[model samples]
Target: MSVWFQSTGRKMNNSSEGQLDKICESLSQAELVAMIELQLSEVDMLQSMFPDPRELVVEDPSVLCDLRDFAEGRTLLLPPHLDLIINLNVGKGRLSMSANLPHHYPAVQPNIFVRSQTLNRDAQHRLNQELLGYLKMLQQGDLCIGPAVTWLQEKGETFFDDHPEEVTKSDANTMETKVIKFARLWIYSHHIYSKVKRKDILDLSREFDLTGFCLPGKPGIICVEGLSRNTEDWWHKVRSWNWQKILCKKLEENELKAEEDISKYRRFSVFEELGSENNIRVKSGGFHVDMGDVFKYLENHESGYVFKEYFGISGRAT
Candidate 1:
């Protein structure tokens, strides 16, 4: 059916007789009108084949993010806690069709790829091959990509929403996963920063002073550096915990006991010094009785050093 509109972008007069008369006069003769009508029909068919903007659920959160990041012209940094997963390309399909079906492939989606500045000729050839393939498909109208733009717009709104509870887990859950997958990049860039202690992928979060929250069922760990070197003073300057207070009390008790031992030793040394010069000795800038000589004399010269004979517990030197 032929349709026309007014300058204001609405349907023209709805009277069928007037519309038919207009179309017939515009076409004039038979053959020319038939061709024009056939061309209009093709356009109508094209509109039906074109997709209305909609989102397909990205089953894998990690893949979903990687595709979006690529679209945004950013690098993907998956955490060590998250396994490297292969996903259907979501950003490079063309505008063509297959045997009656539009050119589309599962796991093959639209995306952008950047060329490495330092790539060798051979590497460049491989890259060119892939990029050319992307362009060629579009030229031949063989690739029909899904609506990633609308999907990202909806997700971004969900993340920044103050009332986040309204968003379902399937929608909001990926927000955190994408964070760990892309930010707190140590877990993504280096291997030594995190090590697997057991079978599960553990977040060595404490080592990096990171706070990681893993998805309920997904394999990736989302982490953020709650406290970094620049921001540490504001956080760790907090008051001590209960265990720290207990430790301080124990240290005070030990210090008092050490002081008591020194006092008792001082009293014994004073008494010995008052008795005779032979009993006097100096240690650590203070006077002390030569208790070793006195002990040997008492033992009738059986032992000269008398360290064992003069032994005392509780801060005594042997």
Candidate 2:
């Protein structure tokens, strides 16, 4: 790992044009490795505002509605341009959201309602009302879903509990477009309870993304349809036999453990901090290796909770 990182860095620093081609190339490789190896946690990804994926960003109401409209309530999808802030004085420690159609990304200044130096009575109340509306939507929003299942007892379609491993050549030839989108949720919370409030939450613990949450016992009731793609590729493997082998491959081999050097535990302190005495225990493979002052070594940094979920992705399932 040290050699690989050092080599990549050397190649980038030696470039004459100083162009980002080499650096970008390395990043692309790193990203692909991260996706396949790390299978990153969704819960932690949303701790900060993340720039929406270019392809996934939806600005049109129709697009958003068609994807997630469960009931009749039309909760407006806030544009990426809008920003939220907190005003402690006026709204009594509540959050205040303001918008700016600034010629730039944020044309207008962020008018916050709560803060140390910022406190306006009317503005705080207006923001409070708006937040209340969102809370209502979150609490009672109609649940729009895709494909159906007998679980909900609403007469839906059948779903696959596991992915298949093998397929026939004749069937593969009939395939149209090959694409399947998965889902991952970022739930912000420390423990489970009847009513979970925002301020009490720490952060999203885990994310059951895409097909990961589509299992029979999974907690996801969401939809992930192929936009312009056909459903043939998805349906073929649905009924194929020997599905358990494929599942074993995915679950065992493709475990999304957090990034940490097993031989030399650097981030192990996080385990103690989370109050994990037994569950967070590490099983060192006996053989050990260490790097003295290896600053260049970088594979993928991961949240400790992700490692904790290594064999327990089923916890989020119903």
Candidate 3:
């Protein structure tokens, strides 16, 4: 009787194993289908939101073709993993975001990297850390890139303000001692609508102890006067950024006298942004500076002669 019961138990176990295999196979296929659908939907949404080719660039062009084929039912194979870069014009700043989505994403979080021209090293690190923290708080299957971008557009500027670059006392003293020659540089750009560029201009001026003003608009104008070497270094850094066109329009250098007050030789005491109140108006795309106001400001500071050098005109009349 024991042998009979044992034989029946073995047969029952074999039948259960066959049924379990079928169930597992079914579940695996369903999971794969679901994953594919999720990925396709997300990619479509992302592409739709950032319609510009420049704004949303695909790292691997083949992946885009594969996705297209799969979506159109021309292939049974799943689309390849996707790597995307999104260029964003966040509130007065610019951000370049890279997102990598694996085969099982939405089931897993994407790897993300954010780059900015405006943020300093420490600020960049803090921004990335906070973004990682934000991802951790989200559910595993939740879509995060959109929210991440929203967070950046809304709060990224805070990080810039929060992490002010520090200049050591020794560095400041060294910079002061290095100022044997006083120099002023006038830089011109096609346009400067980016807040990131503006912030960088401000930060670099502070680092170099430059005193000047930036007129941001259709024809962006920047003037920085300080130690010759520092001004050169600052210009080198600024010109390296992506721009339609940028040029050192004018350069003025003079040897400092022993009793000369740097203040008397400098037109501006601090770096500042000249805006609408200063006769610079924002039009649909860029800024329009009433040359009269600019000439007036420069004339007040005894630096009005630059108008002729910059515009080839004697004054605002021309």
Candidate 4:
């Protein structure tokens, strides 16, 4: 019975292999050659347009060799995908784009990754999403990289224009003494692994000029302190975002006598993500913040008592 089963399995495997060969044979060699030619021509055009070797990097040069081999009929299968990293000057900063062309590239959309130091992570994410949406609207077999670059060159600066520096500048220019109501919020979440969520947290905090820190990992902790209105707005926006489990664990509010008195109520000078610092030990496999580091941070800030509020433990012994 075992020998009969083995023979049946071998026959099934041979049938599948034969079907794969038939599919490969059905693909037009001429069409494959045309795709390779188009890709090669596009690479040349990109190099010519950029005119700077530093601006473009072909991640795997072997892909080009494979293309040549397939074009010359030396190989039966299509070549591996072409990977390109392009750096472009946009506004006051540089935009780095990684474009991966799949085997049937112009017919299918390329995977795009966009990064910019000038824009915050949220802005970068929005820009990349917009670019992807633009690609999807294009007709199939469209050579897309050039148009994508053009789109970035034209509209990318808008993302950088709304930097946190603008908010800082606006605050600095205000000369009137305003009575500020301060508020601090402690938020707890089941986990904070999503890049988009982390970016949103940073962007929202900076937009509202909130100062505190976010410990992003399993059992994420967020602390934001600022003008009562701004902190409320931040919390409102945050709550609108999707979360598996999130709650406002604690809320502290106080009225500052004057703008200068804000220091008395504020515990943090800047909004930042804190789990990756030298003082913190992140658990392996996941970005888990150490409770000991959290206690130390709170102790240094003279807010160590809140550790009990966060966890039932009276101290960091657990």
Candidate 5:
């Protein structure tokens, strides 16, 4: 079946028409049309920027409705999922979320959640907080999934950089019973400016046989990826340091907790830009530390690192 639309001045394709009919069964045509138009506009905007617009996929909630009794929850099942393929300077990431409208949307808020592996409990709570903020600003009865997803994509890079996790965890029951667990430490410290403090972290990295990059500054980030046990040990040693004296301490203690497995990076070594003045260096068979232009030499000799898996998405993964 096809429907003629004066807006596009063309006959809608059979597949789209059928989709629209499915939505119309549960929602008023006016409301469904408005929702569909908003979604298509989002797709068009994404296609303009990305090589493959299909990466930004939106699922029809009506399909999920067939499997559940909505009356039990008294919620409108729309915007089942928004899957985004995010590419940033830090790395490639994916984010997915679900927004279910309450019986009285705009008056009663929608329940939204993050369904991405890249984010943990704290991160999910933070994202939901931001989504609620958007809800408050919107007019009563306004559809919200579009704006919430747009905000997520814009901020995804920071999310991944701050809370990067392994894309896949090994199963102990599988034939490959040897499971390698790793953890990523995003160290934020003001003491990094001091030569002594800088060396302390580098020394710890060598002692643990971990590989990661450090961007030295008053409040800089140290991205480390390595075995979970060693990473936890390295982290505790860092926590015990005299941070107050150096004026460099963790901003969020909870964010620094170790034991999480990092399944992404294949090997350990810091990746740095060749010309940076404060680039961390390796010496004595990658044991000692230098604070100069030595990454050029290491880059030539060190094996390149590989990302083992793509970022994980939530809901029906695209």
Candidate 6:
């Protein structure tokens, strides 16, 4: 292994920018040799772990060209905007990241950018910050850039699992222009009993940007409404579950019209959190629901009725 930390700290702590760049160029070459040797030594293990090149999206000619230039002591122009976009599947959702290697590469971390339609701006920034943090955590002389893609894939998967509402694609046009817009999915199952299963359904629903609930009973019923593609994606996952019967049908114009009539009141949750109790029921159904009657209804038929719980956050869904 390269005694990178010792040399790096000494050279960097003493040298000017021009001298440091020259020294970094030599260090980068040695690091490349070490990386190549390491790869060759562990070729079989790597091949088994990562058999498909398509999964990484780092084998493109542009990437090769940039690395070649860097190796040849050439300072390539940094594009004002993102030069390459790589799409990756992170958990149930997809993610895209644009990245460029700095000329000083192993010495200085690569410039990675995220323009996320999946996550909010703050989350996007956090992802980049965390990636940089991970790079900083690495011991010197390691294949520093090698960890970035893997780290992103793992971290992003975890983030999506936790948030569940942050999947995005590079294309936003489809979201706005697609017709046959709204869809309702009715998934029927007998096996969705445990709290774990319920939470799984809730997480999946949020991931696909669907709004619906699991009606508590022996045979479970899940109702969700969203854009057709998203609803279809949700249905596909529902079928994957060990469900007795899963049937999905598009809601007609008449049904949508009826839903539109109550659209104004739809924002009002029938169930609300007051103090200590969960799942308070609303009796009077208008834009405004009486809390006193809601509490009374919860008290009366709490055990008898199976209430469908809505776990979706309104603005978070795509």
Best by TM-score: 4
RMSD of each: 33.1, 24.2, 19.5, 13.7, 21.3, 21.5
lDDT of residue 221 for candidate 5: 46
Per-prediction backbone clash count? 14, 19, 1, 0, 4, 0
The digit string of per-residue lDDT tens for model 4 on 240-278 reads 444557888999988766346676778898999886563
lDDT of each structure? 0.26, 0.22, 0.70, 0.72, 0.44, 0.46
- Among all candidates shown, the one with the greatest lDDT: 4
For every model shown, what is its TM-score relative to the native structure? 0.13, 0.16, 0.44, 0.46, 0.29, 0.34
Predicted structure 2: lDDT: 0.22
Give the per-residue Cα lDDT of candidate 5 at 127.
58
Expressed as tens digits, the lDDT of each residue in 191-226 for candidate 3 is 888886799789878876799999988778899998
Over all chains combined, what TM-score does candidate 4 have?
A: 0.46
TM-score-based ranking, best first? 4, 3, 6, 5, 2, 1
Model 1 segments more than 4 A misplaced: 1-146, 163-318
Estimate the TM-score for candidate 2.
0.16
Evaluate residue 13 in candidate 6 and report its C-alpha lDDT on the 0 to 100 scale: 26
Better of 4 and 6 by lDDT: 4
Worst 10 residues of 5 by lDDT: 306-315
**Better by lDDT, candidate 4 or 1:** 4
lDDT of 6 by residue, 202-306 (tens): 776776556655544444456665655555555544553333444542242212332244333232223222222434332332223333433343335331122
Which residue pairs in candidate 3 have backbone atoms (N, alpha carbon, C) closer than 3 angstroms, thus clashing? 92-195
lDDT of 1 by residue, 1-318 (tens): 223223324332323333433533443233222323333333244335443322222223464344334334464332111111111222332111111110011112222221222332223334434443544444221232222222222322222324336544544555444321112211111111112221122222333233332111111112222323311211121111101111110100111221133232111111111124443242442323345434433234222232332233112222
lDDT of 5 by residue, 93-157 (tens): 56655443322232223455543455543344455566667656766445555566667767654
lDDT of 5: 0.44
Q: Give candidate 3's total backbone clashes.
A: 1
